[model samples]
Target: MRIEKEVSPEYEIPAVLQHIEARGRRPVLIFENVRNLNGTRSGLPVVINLFGARERLADALGTTVARLPLDYVAREKPLAPVVVDRAAAPVKQVVRTGADADLYELPVLTHHEMDLGPYLTSPSVWVRDLETGWTNCGILRVYVSGPRQMVVNFNIARHTFHYFQKYKAAKRDVPIVLVMGHHPAFYLGAQTKLLADEPHIIGGVMGEPLELAPSETWGSDIMVPAAADIVVEAEMSHSQLEIEGPFGEYTQYYGGQKLSPVAQVRAITRRKDAMYLDIMPGRADHLLLDAPMVEAYLYNRLKDVVPGVTAVHMPVSGTARLHAYIQMRKTNDGEPRTAIASALSSDYRLKHVVVVDEDVNIFDDAQVLWAIATRSQWDRDLLVLPGMMGTTLDPSADDILTAKGGIDATRPIDPHQFAMKLCIPEAVLSRVRLEDYLTPEGLRRL
Candidate 1:
């Protein structure tokens, strides 16, 4: 929905989005009349909350929400990108360099109340690995410090940081491109856990080869998405590290100031009519992008050890990283402990795992919690491993090490071995339709 009312990039835009979120609506928002940082009306519209809904994300993969995780795992084959010339690239239509390429002209937004300042939340920063020559893509937070300078957090554990370390060792500045405003599938593909040429993985997720074009600064050596709405070509300094954040992160908390590499913007290219895309931090749009990939990876890993594993869900309550709920058909009493051990060791970021019977819905939090409460005693079923590697972003973590815990919330394999769960008869459920029992207006109210 396009809002014709005028808004500022400072706090107004994000405040409006927060209000919308409170009402439990995640519609794509277009701020048509937005004031840029320089207090000038922006020609380009700002797009927010594009990835807020699972149904839309599923649509991007050409699958249903229920099958999204499995579908993603099934389509992991790499497909090379097809390179196109500058003339054929939509993102190259309007190129600005030197003094004309001003970052202040764009409608960058400040998301949370305590956020440092306006940030570019959705750019997929691309850098080539020094040894392998593979292009690594990371959706990192960028703090726009000046008209031509920005600070990027090259996380030490991520592929970008690993490549950055090599560049630093060689004493060479890293050439990078911040790709913005591409299709949802493009971003989803970039979030794959597989350590490979990301464009190939992106193409496989897109179900075809992605189009690439020579970057304005590095030419053929560093190709970027040909159809991207906006591209910022820059060089990250190997020596210069700047203080970066106190910015709101995906964990629904502020990430304190830290030293990061400063990127000097060389050029800005975009379509004549482009949309500035922003991912609402600490919300569904920011978290859901990684959900499918994480769920798929965990599910595949669990299935290898336990064939009876039915599904896996990374709940939003855990920021889609720290926790997982696994559902399986248990064959023996020891299966739960085996699954718990395998799952906790599967991913470093996973701090908690809850294994339940197949009959319980893994997607529903209440059902999973209920199973935990009734199924087993804490002394026997609770699994805790201290001093495990975890994400540094986790506020609860002791730096990067955390205590991982799990609960085997499954009942006895035999139906009569444990107390039975209450359920309405299938005959009654099939016969008593809500539509038939209630008035049309009553149904609408419900």
Candidate 2:
């Protein structure tokens, strides 16, 4: 939870990666004097990889990773947001309007070679439903195109796009506030698949109420998180479109350029010493941010369909989107196949799913692979559905349609041979300690 602030003045995007590498998986980084492309220092500090590690994310939610789903489900009720005075809001400490609201002053990083330009990778986009006046918050990739303009990629499948469509239909510009830098729980809550109002409910579950402040341009009806380090007030024009992307995505591939919505910045508000946040696309930070949310969503969906579902894990190796592992207690003959089908149907982004017995550790790739290798029979256990709508980021897909498959890796219902795995007795395991058996030097070598 400690923020590292003694960053070198010359440090830039490459230096951030070097720091991550040097620290050997430190979860949070806060850099001061971040160098921009113009070889000048930005006054604002930068933060990256806030949720890069599993342990850090777990700590943020006040629970273990294995118990996050239960924790998330328990806090589904919305808590009304408390409106705070502009003076009481930390984010409103310094407000810039008109010409002073320049985006170039921020140290937004260019993450990869194929990326178009500096992107505000971790902005929590806030928008309201045109008809209902209900607020919606979610994370979207934004390309910084100009001082007062940015291009936003809105995938039609996401709720944010639906909200934008309503605004477009009404012939009105969509008012949005792109919030950056808050407690990790705020970011995690924003990513949740909510059936109701998200921001306050998520905050309530995280043991706090989300404080709100009125937008400078959008009025009191449109609120942004008061705790944010920086807030960009913008309006996505109903008719204007701009070329966005060719930026690296979580799928580890360049998301091709397409005509997308153009946002015109109206004002910028920040703390006097604002800390900018950026998510490294196609890296651990991006995957960790998305994976836990997907796992929680799948866990909730499967529990209703398959009552015996034990756990769900979207492995990091699969980029935490395209592949999934579901652990369940099998009682019936066709339960594994049923679980697989239900899981695949839960999320279109999932291209492959492996259903394993409760004995298998879904978090461990080796254990899941071992279960599939030993228990599965290709002809009988494999389930394939072709021409299904899938993630556009998947390179193998034919335009958004792709084949989906699943493996029933659980052992047979009345198994004789493959039912049990060999293990050491508890009595022997309890008495054994590697550190007690080895010398300090030997332990160090090991």
**Candidate with maximal TM-score:** 1
Candidate 2, residue 159: Cα displacement in angstroms equals 1.6
Q: What is the lDDT of residue 306 in candidate 1?
A: 90
Q: Rate the local accuracy (lDDT) of all candidates.
A: 0.90, 0.83
- The candidate scoring highest on lDDT is 1
After superposition, the stretches of candidate 1 with alpha carbons farther than 4 Å from their true spots are none
TM-score of 1: 0.96
Write the residue-wise lDDT of candidate 2 on 1-446 in tens digits. Answer: 33344443332554566576566665566666676534567777777777777888888878887887667657655777788999999999999888888888788788777778778889988888877777777888898899889998878778888898888888999898999988888887888677457776667666678999888996787898898999999988899998887888888899889999899899999998788888877878888887887888788789888888999999878999999999999788688788888888889999999999888999999999999899899999999999998988999999889999999998877767555789999999999999989999999977
User: Model 2 reaches what TM-score against the true structure?
Assistant: 0.93
